[model samples]
Target: MRGPEARPRFGLSLRLLALTLVFVLLAEALVFLPAIGRARVVYLEQRLAEAHLALLALEATEDGMVDGDLQRRLLGHAGAVAMTAYQSGFFRLRLGPDMPPRVDAAYDLREVGLWPPVGDALMVLTRSQPRLIRVAGISPKDPRVAVEVTLPEAPLRRDLMRFARRLLGLSLIVSLIAGAVVYFSLARLLLKPLSRLVAAMRRFEAAPEDPGRLHTPSTARHEVGEAERTLARMQARVREGLIEHARLAGVGAAVARINHDLKGILTTARLESDRLEAQTRDRDPDLARTTEGIAQALDRAVALCAATLSYAGSELPSARPRRLAAHHELTLAAQRLHQAHPEIAVNLDCAVDTTLSADPDLLARSLDNLTHNAAQAGARHLTLAAHTSNHQTTLTIADDGPGLPQRARDNLFQPFAGSARNGGTGLGLPIARELTQAMNGHLNLHQTTPSGTTFHLTLPT
Candidate 1:
């Protein structure tokens, strides 16, 4: 009974937002690697340029020398513990003050490659203790030889740390912006529509007959729009089906009441016909024949009323199964049909000698309905054939009358709508089918053409 608002914590929206954030951060990480590497290289290059400029003071002096105080100031200003210049194949120590005892790492800017800086940057970031490192690069103004400098890693590490913090902060901001854009865009385009569809389905399930639950579909020309259109059509069909079912139920109830009255009237008419036949026998042959025909008509009317009531009842009669010869049932139905319509010929061709486990009364009634329909359709010749094959019994009833018209064929098994002849109640085939199904059997129209119509009934052996 979970409602739409009771969606789980890790629902679609949260998952979509999380996925968007992850993808945005991943893209930012790609840019961050090269940016950090470039920053480190630029920081070291600036230090080299400063150290070269500091050496210019020595060149200005008459003896190419500087006082200790001036040298110390220059070294401190250049951010290097030691500075050396390689000019014209001669390496000269230009400045040195409080140099470290050992150099932990060395880097040559001339050997710099696209990817080497990224690896070097990562190495610097991973270090724990500060150590002295040597860096060599050609002076920006004078490219004849290289300027070399020794510096502690602590200052560079601090600068890199500051740059990293800024980059991380910037990446987070960009990721948030991008994630928000993607999440909202997808929610509008897909998630919101999908949520609406789910809610509609839940509401529809609660009360399918309610027309208001069916929403007007979106006109978007995408898959989500198609889904909405399909759902709308399905809901519309379900509503139509429910209406039809309720209408049928009402019809069944009315038919039950009419059938009850009709049966009582037919029974009284049958008794009167019997008395009239007794009085007219032998004294008036024509009058006796007329009374007999009236009795027959009343009998058929009573049977039809009974069958209609059976079908319209809340439930079918429970099956009373017994082993009986299927051919015997067919013969009995044919005999009864022949008695009712003596003008028509009923030919029974039962090749099946096997017996079937079924309700004999229901089976006979179904066959009787089929045969009666055939006789009423002005069929001159009716054929009832029974056969057995593969542990099943099949009974086929065929008639040589005008085949069912288009209207009757369209609703051949629908009560009151499948009447082949005018004034027919159209319940024969439907009752037959219902009864057959109640006994775990099938009734199907085998064939229907201008020449003849055939119905096949199959039952388990």
Candidate 2:
């Protein structure tokens, strides 16, 4: 249920500890069970061997077969301290009042071989008698006769049960201690890095720009180091972007102040041109031509000033779709170009019925910047053309001038970069590109050939 950022949320180290503990406990159980059984067997075999040797000694008496007197003497002595001496089963001697009482219910003895010399060749199980180990050997002088001993199993069973409980207790204590030590060691060595990473993230959220906070120190030389470096880089890039946005806001404010006064001057120029056109009409043809040219120049100046002001504005209005004549935007671009370079002649080439959905004012500004750039490259003739392709409309402005310089090509449409010509404010291409994109359109440099340069403006149908 927790997200990735949540701390100590069943991480890699804890999972590894859990898996390792299961295996360790299983292995201990395997060894502990078998080891307790083996210890009980070894002790039982030593006691049985000792009891059988005493019976053999008793057979050495003058009565060569079974010795009742020797048996009674041995039983009285050995049974007194059987449990303490063997730490296993009891010792018993037959043929005495103290010998195991005969039971009406008795079962035949079955020989169950304990591995190697550890236990007797046969043992007895009976409902009315105690469980037993049967030990027997031949008389030293008479091959026909045999000596025998019976050891009760109660003491051995009790001792083995006690030893098993102790062994299990020790194993439990040891495993718990080992698990705790391993857990602490892993928390320090492995989980420590993750803890530092969490603390660093907290600091980053609290006061990201504060240089007073120390960053997480990376000790690992593997992918952890790479992660630390990557986080630092991302923080740096974010900081730089914030600074750039602030700078752009300031620039916008300053341009807005300058545009107010420039608009007033443009208004005065338009009024003067209107008066000149009224006087030169019909009476002097040559003078009227010159007056019209002055009016066109003034109009271009006003439009150029407006475009610069629009660039300084925070946002421009959306394009209003209307019936746009083919030559309207081109005429505006040519008039604006004449204000800066009157010698250049701009020609419009089309089938004359082309139309596009766009804001004429914004499109003219875009084309004016392009034509002015071409003129500055020593272009003597400029061409503006309109065409349609695959449900889209395109406007192209080209010139027979030098191509764009190599240095500015990469960032030609980015802000503050494409100012290779004199009297060029670098924002022109960038603003043009921005406005074009806002209209759901695109502006691209179609070519930079030796004979001329071309720019393409494409708008969706």
| Residue pairs in clash, model 1 | none
Over 1-461, each residue of candidate 2 has an lDDT whose tens digit, in order, gives: 23345555787777868966776678778767566646655554455445445545544656533556665565554431221112123333323344444332221122323342223211211123446544444323333434343455555566666776787788888777777787778687666666666667677666656554436456568665666766666666665676677797888778767776777887797788778778878788788788788777767666656766766665754676555766666777788888889999888886666777777777776777777777777899999888988867898888898778775677798655676664455677787777787777899998887787788988764
lDDT of each: 0.88, 0.64
Q: In model 2, what lDDT does residue 78 have?
A: 40
**Clashing pairs counted in every model:** 0, 1
List the candidate 1 regions with Cα displacement exceeding 4 Å.
1-6, 88-93, 97-101, 245-461
**RMSD to native for every prediction?**
10.4, 15.1
Estimated TM-score per prediction? 0.55, 0.40
Candidate 2 regions exceeding 4 Å error are 1-182, 214-237, 260-408, 419-461
Model 2 lDDT, full chain set: 0.64
Candidate 1 versus the native: TM-score?
0.55
Maximum-lDDT candidate: 1
Error of 1 at 177 (Å): 2.8
